[model samples]
Structure formats: C-alpha cells, structure tokens
Target: MAMAVLERFAVLSSPDLDEFRHSVSQFLTPHRLTPLAGNTAGVHTDLSKTSVGPVSLVYCRNSGVELGVHLTENVDYYDINLALHGRNRVTFGRDEVVVDASRAAVISPRMRVDMRLSDDYRQLHVRIERQALTDHLEAMLGRSAPAVIRFEPDMDLTGPAARGWLRTVRILLQDLDQPAGLAEHLLAAAPWANLLMTGLLLAQPNNYSPQLERIDAGLRQPTPVRRAMDVIECDPSADLSVDRLARAVRMTPRSLQRHFRSALGVSPHEYVQQVRLARVHEELRLAEPGTVTVTEVALRWGFTHVPRFAGLYRKRYGTPPSQTLRDAL
Candidate 1:
C-alpha cells in the first residue's frame, strides 16, 4: 500500500539544451551539463519516466550532439545505467568505464560522477533510493552494514542473470505505457519493486558479496534461523518463499531448512503456515460475521484450496472455518 503514494508516469522533451538538462535534473539528480562543441541550432532530447514505489525506471535519448555532465556532490540514490544506443564514458570516483549495451554501470550514492555521452546515446536507467536499498541489505545481512555499500563501476550485463534483469525492466517499462497499467495497483507495484531491488543486489558486485558468499557456505556468526523467524513473525503476509527467507538470513535453502528444523522442530514452510493460520484465526474471530467469509480470510493468508484449507483449519482450530465465522457473527 505504501507504493500507492507516488505518481506513476511522466514524459518530457525539449529541443533547447538548457531546458532539457533542467528537466532531466528535476526528474533525476542535479548536475551541470555542457553541450559538446557542435554548434548546432537544434538538438532533441526525450525522456520518459515511471515511478514504481521507491524505484524509478527512466528512458532518455539525446540526438545530434555529444554532452558532458558533472555531478560533484553525490546524489542520495543508486543509478543503474544501461546504454541502449551509442555509448557513454563514465568517470566515478577513481575509475572510468565505457557503458554500452553489453556493459552496464552502477553509480553509488554521494559519489562524484563525470560522464560524456556520444551523439546518438540512449539509455535505460533505474534509480533506487539509498535508504530502501540499505534497508534491504540490512534485512539480508540480518544486521546493520558496517559501512557504506559501494558497487564496482562496471557490470557485465550480457550474463544470463543480467539479461533476465533487463527483461524485467523492459516488462516494467511496457506495463507503465498502458493507460490502466498493472503498476498502478499497489499490490503489483510492490512486488515489481522488490524484484528489481533483489535482482540488482544479486546481479551487481557490491560490498556485501563476501558476506553473501559466506552465507552460502553456511559460515555465519549471527544465527539465520532467529532472523528468519523474526521476519516471519513481523510480516506474515510478505512473499516469504524459501528462497527469499534463505536470502534474508544469508543461507542456502537447504541450510535454512536444516537450521529451522534443528531449532524449532519444524521446517520453515510449516512454520509459515502455522503463523498464517494463527493470523487467519485472529482475523476470523474479529470479523463481522456476514461481512467477510472464511474463504476470503483463508486466501488472504495464502491458503488457496478451499477444501484443503477447511481441513487444515479443522485440524488446527478444532472446528470448520465456517463454524468459526458463524460463531463470530
């Protein structure tokens, strides 16, 4: 529901270089832009942007000229740039990288960046809030990060995983084009935002890579099981699949399952079901009898099959779900 707070889409275009630069800065970050020495009377710039929760998808093209942009003070977000046409020479911190279709770049927050774009350059950029990403990292690490998380300037986008991430971005952009897009709904947008963030975290090499690798190896000081349990208890309605839970606590699925069984005498899946069942019971007891049904409550808590859900409800609550609803009424 928090995803519903922002406007969904916008488009901006201009033939005036200064106007275009100003518009782009308003949409993204503040930067000084200088047109390269092509004494042209007319240059065209087009920008399209879609905001889905904390993440923004932007596509921009500047034709018939080269340009240089300087961001002396780092912006408070991460920029993942994918050059779709032509190329860009990006200098961030001490490193410089050429970004094109095959090579992507992740620009960290608060880092000075100098970039030069070719005449026909077009790019698909994803901007994610630093706080949002840092929160996600903390959730994955099961603790606060010791320092600022920085990424390598260049990333190989031709790999299978990276390609998959690109496909997701393309789909998101396409969805945003519709008048009644799926992203307009909070439920759809929230998951899409999470997917993009999680995908970026996994795809890009960052400060947390070693810790993640350690998690995969089952060598961690903080207990992942406890963290996983805490997450489940805090938000049972979250999309807490085995993979997501495992990633949160920095463990392989097998490792997480083993730890859950060893500590709680139940698998993670079973624990989640139990928690959902309890939540369903609480909601049913509090519901106005005819206003809500058992099936609705069951589905809300992730139980899909009505007959099977009734059976489980009976087993857990010593009564049919309908009876619980009826009694509450």
Candidate 2:
C-alpha cells in the first residue's frame, strides 16, 4: 500500500495580540517580549483552556531576506518553535544550526540564544510554564532536567512530529474568539500537550524514567475503536468483516459490535461500506486519466463484482463511478 502522507494538524495564526496576551498570561507569568526587527510578531490570547495549561499561540512572519532574534535574559520556562514555512538559522547555547520547513526546535529555560531566518518565514511559538513541563519531565525521567538542552534543529525529529503538533495547535487556536468558555477548551488540550512533549522527549534520548512512564501511559490510553477505524482507512479494499476488524483491534466480534453500535449507532459492516464508498467518491472527484478504472477503484475498496458495486454507487451518489471519472477528466 502506498503511504499517503496525511496532514494531521495545522498551526494558529492571528491579527490580534491583546487577546493573545491575556490567554497566555493564564499559564505563564507575562513578560514583555522585545520584537525582532523587520518582522511582524504577535501573541493572541485564545479564550480556550487546556488540561495542560492556558492557551496562547504566537505567530512571527518575516517577509524579507532575513530576521534575527536575540534573547538577553534567562527565562524560567520552556518554549518551543516550529518553522511553518521557509528556513531559519538558530543559535542555541554552543550550537549554531539552520532549520527549515519540516523541522522544529526547542530552547530550554534560561538558555539565551540568537535566531536568524534566511527567507520569508512563519513559525508557531509555544511557551509553557517551566515547572509544568518540569513536573511532566520529572514524572517521566525520575529527576530534574539538566540545566539546559542545546538543540541543533534536525529534520528527523522535527519533520513528522512538528507537523503533527502544529496541526493540533491550529485547531485550538481557532476557538479564540467564538464567545465560548476558553478555560475548558484549553484544559482539554492536555492530550495534545502530552503528545507534543512525548515527541520532544523521544527526540532526545535520555535516561528519564518518569518521562518514559508518561509516554507509555499515553500509549495505553484506550483507542481500539480509533485504531480499527485507521486500519479501515488505510486499506478500504481489505476483507473488513466484523470478526476481522474486531481481531485487528484485539476485541471480540460481539464486543466490538456492541461498542461501535453504542458509540456510533451503526453496524460495523455498514460503517465500513460507508467509508469505502466515500473513498471511491473522493477519488472520482480527482481521479487521474485511465489509471483509476471504475472496476479497479471499486474492487480496491472491497466492492467485488462490478454490478453490485455499480448499483450501490449509484444509489448513494446518484451517479456511477464511470461518470465520476469521466467528469474528472
């Protein structure tokens, strides 16, 4: 099966800074951030609250050749930056590095550094209370963080993980002005926060026992149904019988059926068919010339026997797959 690189999340962007500051102050002690020359940077208070901490997202955009940032004072909290677009030259402690799209970097508390961008760039900046992250770290590692971590931006660590983290951040960032309870929404972001931290911890290999525990605990979180859905999504053409899907998630067929029915109000077979048809419909919208045949696409998503597939397709979409592909052309 081809690995379709799915975009899991996006980052927050804004034109409002006052609201951003108020939201950030909920979690971190507010400090005046000196703006960088030749770039636009703003922090917006998202009215949402997460389980991990209060929500505030920052955006920095540089439209010219380069932008540089110098931290003069030692901060008492943890901060993370993800280059959403273009490139950056970062100097942290004794390390000097260049980071571009698909890469992320972190600066430890009290670590003064200089950051330079080589092209027009935008980045998502997240600041967390030092003690909150420290508690998580200590719980995972069984000790305190070494005074500092000198990070050299590496694509391997940042590419996939950073993309995933930013996608989730962007979602919460949107609820900032909806006249809703920001605190509850922000608190619910704990899972995302945990995932972000887990990715960072995995980035640097250290003997932190508590940190390991946290990651392990996250893995143990009940997600069998989600996992089963993912399997269905990955290869819709497979034999997705009730017993088979149940086995994939390590649950009994009866148990799985009961749980899915309770949660989604649909039978497993019906759900799988719906997913499979949806995939066919999507492909039909942009299917390439001749490469994706009506018969092939249908069979691929577990619709064996062209007549049955065609009948089902017509019933749901009011058009056949052949019509879809032809229109796409």
Candidate 3:
C-alpha cells in the first residue's frame, strides 16, 4: 500500500526542484524544501490532498532523494504524519522522533519543525484544522477552555487506541474514493469526524487528559446498546443476531432486547435490518450503474427477499434501489 492513500487526488509529480518545492507549498504546508543528496536530478516529488470534513488526507513522496523541509513558524493545524515507506526524522521544536509506519509524529500548533526525509520516504499527513479541533475540544469539555489543547509530539501507533483511530482514517479514505458515498453525506460525515476527533482526544494523552479522565471516572460505562449499534455500524455484514450481539456485549438476550427497545425504540432484529437497509442504500448510490443489480445489492447486505427489500428500500430512501443506482451513475 505504498503511496496508495489518497492517490486519486494527485496534485503534482515532477523532478524539478523549484516545482517540487512549489507543489509542497501549495498542496501541503509552506516549507523550505531542498535536496540533501546534493541535487534533485532524479528525484520525483509526488503530492496529493483530499479534504474530508475537518481534516485533509495528504500523501506525499520525494523518491530517490534525501530531502530537508523547514517550517520556521508555528503552524495553524495539527499534522499527524505517518510514514508509509522508509523513514523520516521529524523535529518539533527541540524534540525529535523517527517516524515510520508504526510511529506517528503529531505536530501541534505553536511549534517550529524540521523534517529530514530518507531517499525512499513517503508519508500520509492527516491535517486537522485548528478551529475545528478547538470546537471539538470545547464540545468535549462541555465548557469553554481559555488554553489550547496541546498533544504530546510522539504518538505510539502500536497501541489499540491508535489502531482504532486509524480504522476511521481508512474508512474516510475509502469514502473519499466514492463519488456518492458516506463522506459526502452530512449525517454520516459528522459521525466519522467526531469518531476521529473523539478517538484522538481520548486515546492520546494531552493537556486535557487529566480533566477528561476525571470527567470519565464520574460517568457510567457506555451503554451496551451503543456498543451493539457500533458493532453493526462498524461491520454490518457480520452475524449480528441478538444472541451474537448480546454475547459480544456480555448481556443476556432478553436483557439486550429490552435495552435496545428502551433506548432505540426497536428490537435488535429491527435495528440490524435498518442498518442493512441503510448500507444497501449507500451501496446503490455508490455503485456503478451497469455493474450492479438491486437483488445483488440487497443480498450483499443480507436482504434475501427481493420484494421485501424493494419495499423497505423505497420506504426508507423514498426510491427503489435501481433508481438510486441510476441516479448515481
């Protein structure tokens, strides 16, 4: 998957030194980019950026050339740089870390940075907007904070928290490839953005970790119904019968059903079916017109009966699945 993330949003691919510097300055951040290996004769700078909600996923590579990039001022956004191939040394202020696939350097605002890239270095930069992050932090705190949230520079990506956060990133990247997909829907996009933001805030230790921990210690564990719904949402195609879901969440079947009814006003079966219908609706909208059929789409999401699915799809989406596919194409 080298240089695979956000490859569709290519901005530049050139060997010219000035052009390479200009491309990085335009597509990513303003930096003094110079070749460290004497000359950039055979080096190709590849860059791409795709914006999704409050963040942008940028893929960049300077192939066959050691490079040095300097950012002399404080940046406005948080840069989570994950190396895809080879290695790089990112220096944030006085702290420096060697970043690779398993280690990410999270550069927060109010810091100067210097980056040394190996000859084969390639990376994906998750650029989170400053204002959006501040707003999210305020929402999480349930109050205004006068001080900015500053994250520790080096993030260990081997932990479960980082892995889960990366899942949301992969989901967003997948959606960005679809013309009529979840990222384009406000309702869906907001949750994904919130999931990413909330995950990062909770997973990574920051200036507000102590406060967040205090708040969390005072609250009860997340409701089982929410976990069940997350299971379905994360992988709707999984076997999600009430028995399985209840077992997954360590609850009895009857108790799980009761909780689902009380919280969602629907039984587990109904909720799963609703999720499947929604998934089918999304699939139809993102599928190519000539490549798929309504029945195929229905069955993929576990809707076996054609007539019932058509009726449900129409009632839920106000259109037949075929019509949605047609519109998408």
Candidate 4:
C-alpha cells in the first residue's frame, strides 16, 4: 500500500459516492460531486486537512473511480492542486489543463470549475484564502489599489522558482506532520504560513506579475563592510570571533571592533550573531523538515547555548527557529 499524504490528519474516509458526498458536504459549500461510472464498487476514498497560517493543505485520493466535481458559486479561496501520481483534468469554460506531478492546476476564486478525476489520483491541495492573498500582494507591491487578484490556469513545476516552491511545500507538510513540528507555536507557524503564500505569489504568475518582476529586479544585494562582513557571511558557521574577523580584514582586534561598531552600530561579535542568525534562518527554510532540528541548526552556526540562540532568533525574526522549517506551493 502507498503512504497516504496527510494521513496523520484524516478528515474523511468512504468507499463510494453517496457516503463521500455526505461526508464532504460539511467541509465545502456550493459544490457537488458525481461518479462518472455507473458503479463505484470496491473503490476506497480518503481526505485529510492541515490548516497552517492563512492556507489549508488538503489531501484526497481514491482507489480507482472516475469522479466529476462542479463549483458554480463564487468561492473565497484558490486551490492549487498537484497529483502525486496519475493525472487529473480541470476546465474553465473553453480553457483546460491537465495536472500531474510536474504540473499544477490553480483553481481561482469565483470561477466556474469543472473537474474530472480518475484512477489513483492522490493529490495535495494548497488552498489559500482569497482576500489574504490579495492583502499580501498589496503589501508586496507597496500599494493598496483595492483590486482583486487572479492567476494563470496552470503552473509549470519544472522551473527553478517552481521547483523551490514545491520543496517549500514538502518542507511545510512533512515538518508539520511530526509530533514536535513547526505547527505548535503561532510565532513560528504564522510567519511560515505567510511565507508559503509569499512564495506562491512570487513563483507563479498573476495579474501583478509584471510589477512583481520589476520589484524583484530592483532588489540589490547588501553591501559588505570593509570586506570583513562578506567573509563572515560567506561561511557564517565559522569561528567569527573579533580576533578571527580582525585577522581576515587585516586590522587589530580593537580596530576591527571600533570600525564594525562605527559602520554598523554593532561590535564584531554582535555582527556575527546577526549573520549567523540569518544563515540559520536560510538553512531552516531549506532543510528537510523531518531530518533537521533547531538545535542542530544552532550548533552548526556556532551557537553553543541553544536557549540563548532561540531567544536571539525569536527576537530578530519575531519567530522561533523550529517554526521556520517550512513554506510554498
């Protein structure tokens, strides 16, 4: 038997159409499901949900049955659906898309949706709330035009940004599935949730994509201070004490400390903490959720005391180290 996605949070389980309808109705509104086959005997179905931040990660699959879904009402969310294996069809009037492991179907809000799902169509549904997405876009563009948002019908999962997006999704789902996962604390989980939305907005094209592209192009790398900051950032997990940084930058320890404080308002030691904290954040986001821990990340960045590192991380990011191990899709 294949491992079920989101199996830790099963929300529905049924053998056929009637029970599936009844069980799923309470979960969604203004939608209907019908079996295309004359009979659905011996077919097994399962559904699960994990809500994080402003989005819901939903999983559903069937043993082997042709099913149709209709959404006629104006909905309030977007469902970016990806099948782990097999294929599914989605149509918006004349436009249509086929989604599988390398492609995704973005079901936008308020659109008339017609769907055909068959066989072992196991899928992970990234359900993001419509207005929250709109709000996030406004913040990203630094404007509040009071306009709604829409996206292209399909997403290519093969591109670099899209692949990163998928990895982030895996991180979010796999990490939260654990007993001591990032979902426990709002401080950690909420930002990660926002980050997931942000990644989707940036990765996939939308109405404001041109402007987003412009903004992305405008971003410049941070300038290093006397090349010492550059060396420290190159490998933040190194022994970046004042003496070491001074040697690298060709200055006495006292001179290096004074220069760092004068240029950045922090001593060499304090500056290293900022860089190491950022490295930890970067690593946590990219780390395989089930395999890496916050403690491991801190120690890797030369943080000897886990509690002190946690405090600094929380203060700097308004989130904890563990909560950051997820994002995207």
Candidate 5:
C-alpha cells in the first residue's frame, strides 16, 4: 500500500526552519545529511508573508561535501529551488545535475532527489503544491508538463530577464509579513511564474527532442479518447453506441470510428461491448452466487439484449456467466 501525507507550515524565524526541516525529514523515509568533501556547512532562513500563498521559502548553507542526503519522501506537491548564493548538486532517478546561483530547479514531490551543496552555497527555496503548479502552467503555456524534466548538466541560467523576474518575486515575498486578502495570491503569481519558467525552458537547447515533441503532441489528442473511455467505464450499464460517444466528444460518428480505428485498431462499438463483457466477467468471478444473477450482471453493464449478450459472453469467456457466478460461491 502507498502511504500519503500532506503537511502545511508557515515559518517566520530561524527556529521555524529547524522545525520544518525536522518535520520534512521525518515525513520522508529515514534520510541523513553529512558534510561534503573538504567543506563545512551552515544554514539560515527567514520567512516574511508565508500565508500569502502555498509558497514556502527557506535559506540553505553549505561549505563542503554533503553526502548521504536523500529526499525519500513521496510528496504530492511542487518544490522549486532558486539558488541564491551556493552551488547545489542533485541526483534524481539516476540522472545527476548541478545547480548554482545562476539557475533554478523544480522537482515534483513523488520523485526522490538527493542534494550535495557546495561549501560556499546559499539559496532561496520554494515549494508549491503540485496541482497549483500544473494548472497554472498548463493555462499559461497552452500545454501540459511532461512526466519528467531534468535540466541538462550544461544548461545555462544566465538570462538577465529570467533572473530579474526571480529577484522581483523574491523581493515581493520578503516585503510581505502576512497574506494580503485583497486577491488570490496563487492566481496572481501563476501567470508570472509560468511565463518566466516557460521562457527558461525554451531557452534550454535540447530540452525537447523530436521524439519527445511527438510524444507531447500525442498526449494532447489522447484527452478526447480518454474522456470517451471514462464515460464508458464509469457507467457500463448505459448505451455506449458510437453515435453517443461521438457526440460526447464533439465529433461525428464516422469521425469517431475513424479515430478509434487509427489509434487502437478497433471500432468504437466493439470496444464498448468488449469492456462490458469484461466487467461482467469480473463481477461473476468475484461476486457471491446468491448476491447477483448472471443476467442481472449482464444487464447492469448495458447488456439489455439478453440472448445476444450471453452468446457473446460465452464465446469470449469460454464459459457461461452463470457458471462463473456459481463457481464464485
């Protein structure tokens, strides 16, 4: 079983940073930090208006080789780190990269990331909730974030405009002592941050290869297909005719059929029937005999035509639905 934990914190002092780090360590799997080679490390953090948004900022220090540090926690949020003063090295999923005062990094919570700070490094850290980042970025970029993104080892972060934006946001954060209730802070920051990040991403050469670009294009079109499948899966008892599905996806019936054939090499009506039969088979295999009738199971998944449904079910499953239901008892 997967364990999930969500923690919300507002820190305004040095002590708060200590407490927050402790909480984060405990929440993740047991992870320890040690000094890096030939360097000593120290950290200082101050928070201004923490309640303004889901933004949590911290300051970090390092002066040597830091080792054995692993972010083992599976977080469901967004962590964006801006290196203000020190160089940071990270190993995420076997891909190693180093970030410094010139560049920023964003890591999703579910992945593990290990950090090694340079002895002279100091930085500002920000963690935003995952959904907030995605929704905001998608709206601003007119696309979705890829499943994974790791900056290449030699990627540059020297763009003056990008650096200026980051500085301005940090200054704004430093000036606020509490959340202003005048407007939604997240809504206000979403565009600014997305635009800034978008520019940064585009500036990185080799960020999107031909294969990756093709995959990205495919993901955009798959939404309609996924939605049609969801409707069928959600209520298998309903009529899932191609005409209905086509209307649901805002396409003509012929177009829908063509799409399914091109994408999955199957007709839409056949797909629905296959799904319904599979659902009925599962229920028969797991359900108690007296609790449900084979005919009832068939009808529940849109098999109103009893004889035809049974004939097809037996041919596909190599047994009558009634026999499977009886065996479950």
Candidate 6:
C-alpha cells in the first residue's frame, strides 16, 4: 500500500537558523543545514505542503545555505525537485545534476543526496511513495517488476510531455489553495493522484521504459487469458473494455471472446464485472464505519448505475451492498 499524504495544507516557517533546519527536517526529511561563510544573514525558511492521496506536494523556499541530507539508511520514497528560482547542485551517489528552471532532479529511494542551494532558491517538491510506483509499474507491464525502478537523475522540463506534467502540478497547487478544491473529496483525489503518478511514469525515462515499450509494441508473449487476468487483478478499477483487453493480449476481440467463453465459461465483459464486484465487496468489508458508502465503493470500482450495480451485487453475494456494509460495521 502507498503511504497516505496529509489531507490538508501545513505551513512551517522559522527565522532562527537551527530552528528552521529542525522544522524542515520534521516536515520533510532529516538533514543538516550550514550557512556559507560570510553569509550570516538571518535564516528564513517557508514551506507549504498538501497531500493529494499518496503524493505530497511541497512548495519550499529558503535563505542562502548548503544542506547535507542523508537517506542512506532510510530510503523510503522518491523525491523530485523542480526548480522554480535560483539554482541547485544535487548529487546522488556518484552522479550529480545542476537543477534549474529547465532541469529537474529525481532522487531515487536507494540514493543519498547532498544539495548546494543558491541564495534565492525556491522549488516544488513532489514526493511519491515507492510501493505506489511499484504497483503502477506492475500494472503497466502486466506482471511484477523484476527490481526497484530507477529513473534518470536529470529530467528536461522543456519537453512537451514535461510541460504537460508541470501544468498538472500547477492545477493541483491551485486547487489546494481553494476553499472548495477537488482534492478535498476522496473520490476526486484518488484520480488526481493517480494522474500525477501515471504522468511522471510516462513523461520521464525510467528503468521500466524499455519493458513497457516492448509491451506496447506487442513483441513479447503471454497467454491471452493469463495476460488478461493479470491486467484485471493489477488494476480492478480500470475501464476494462473487451477491445482494450483484446489489444493488450494481441488478439482480436472476437477471438478473445471465443477463448474466454471456451475456457472460463463467461464473456470477457462478464469476467470484468465479476472482478469489479468482488473488489467492491472487499472494500466495503474493510472500509471504516460511516466513512464510506456503498455508492462510493461501487463507483470507485467502475459501477456507475446504482440500481444495476445493486442488482448484480445481490445476485452474486445473495445480499444487497448496503446490507453487506451494515454487517461490516
């Protein structure tokens, strides 16, 4: 499971140099901050953070300083720094990158980073939990990833895809600031966070890119039924259309339908519905009392019509979804 992000904005700031470092460490990561020689001006730090599900968005600005950040032993998540002003030299393991307006730095969960920031440095930091990303990679490949996914340190933000990612970040930031933002609702937050994760995986070059390309090219092989099952199990919430499943396994829809009927005794569409209904039932069973509704769980698993979904749920489980929820509570 992915780590949950904060549900509301948190602001941390301090004028004392040592206090500033301590505050930042508590909010983000543990690190030592050292003011450069002859740069003894009052230390000022400001950070505003909001979490959209499992992703954390942080806006940070600090006075002139150098930081010695250590994650060698406790590398738990991926951190991406997009420079908004000034400059930074970020070193990860043996590699280093100069981060500026045009370049972003991606620090993997396995690496230790040391950063040197210029006087007017400001940045947007995106933190993604490792498990969440790993799950996504597995979904994309229709199988478990072989190892931890690694990303190129330097990302060119001038590219078209990168620009689109930035646009999404901006939109999320704007919504976070609004009193009635989309992120305030769980239903909306889930998709928005998922979009950010998917966007980064697609726009950036990563260790899994080659394998994903192979799948897209329809080169390597998996049995049609096995591949289809993998896709459904990996992401039961996806829109699992017959055509989509057919293309994923490199088979015509007609052939897929015939095979599914012959082997599973059900059409592809029916199988998808069964998977979704099971997912909804599991969620309802585990959901906190009074915090979630049957409709929300149904919609989350792609069931749009309440009457139709309830009828199917009853037929499958011998009880209405509302009754299932009540029993769980």
Predicted structure 6: clash tally: 0
Per-model CA lDDT versus the true structure:
0.78, 0.58, 0.78, 0.76, 0.57, 0.76
Q: Indicate whether candidate 1 or candidate 3 has the larger TM-score.
A: 3
- With a 3 Å backbone cut-off (N, CA, C), the pairs that clash in candidate 4 are none
Poorly placed runs, candidate 3 (over 4 Å):
221-329
Worst 10 residues of 3 by lDDT: 213-222
TM-score of each: 0.64, 0.43, 0.65, 0.65, 0.44, 0.64
lDDT of 2 by residue, 1-329 (tens): 01111112222234454444444444444533333554444322122223335223455444434445555566566566656677777777677656555555665666766777644566556666655565566445422343343333443434565555566555545543234634246555676566556555655443453435443553454687767767776777789999999999999999878766655556778768877887777677668787788888887778888898888878877878788889999
Tens-place lDDT per residue, model 1, 225-252, is: 7689788878877888999999998999
What candidate 2 gets wrong by more than 4 Å, as runs, is 1-56, 141-163, 170-189, 203-329
User: How well does model 5 score by local distance difference test?
Assistant: 0.57
The weakest ten consecutive residues by lDDT in model 6 span 1-10
Worst 10 residues of 1 by lDDT: 1-10
Clashing pairs in 6: none
In candidate 6, position 294 carries an lDDT of 90
lDDT of 3 by residue, 1-329 (tens): 43566666888888776787777776566788878877656777788887768877888888878988898557878888888898989987678999987888888887779999998788888888888887788666544443677999888988898888877787778777767877777677668777888888887789988866644542333567667767877877778888999998889999988877665556889878877876787677679758988888888888778898899777766777788888889
lDDT of 5 at 148: 43
Error of 1 at 238 (Å): 25
The per-residue C-alpha lDDT of model 4 at residue 37 equals: 78
Clashes of 5: 12
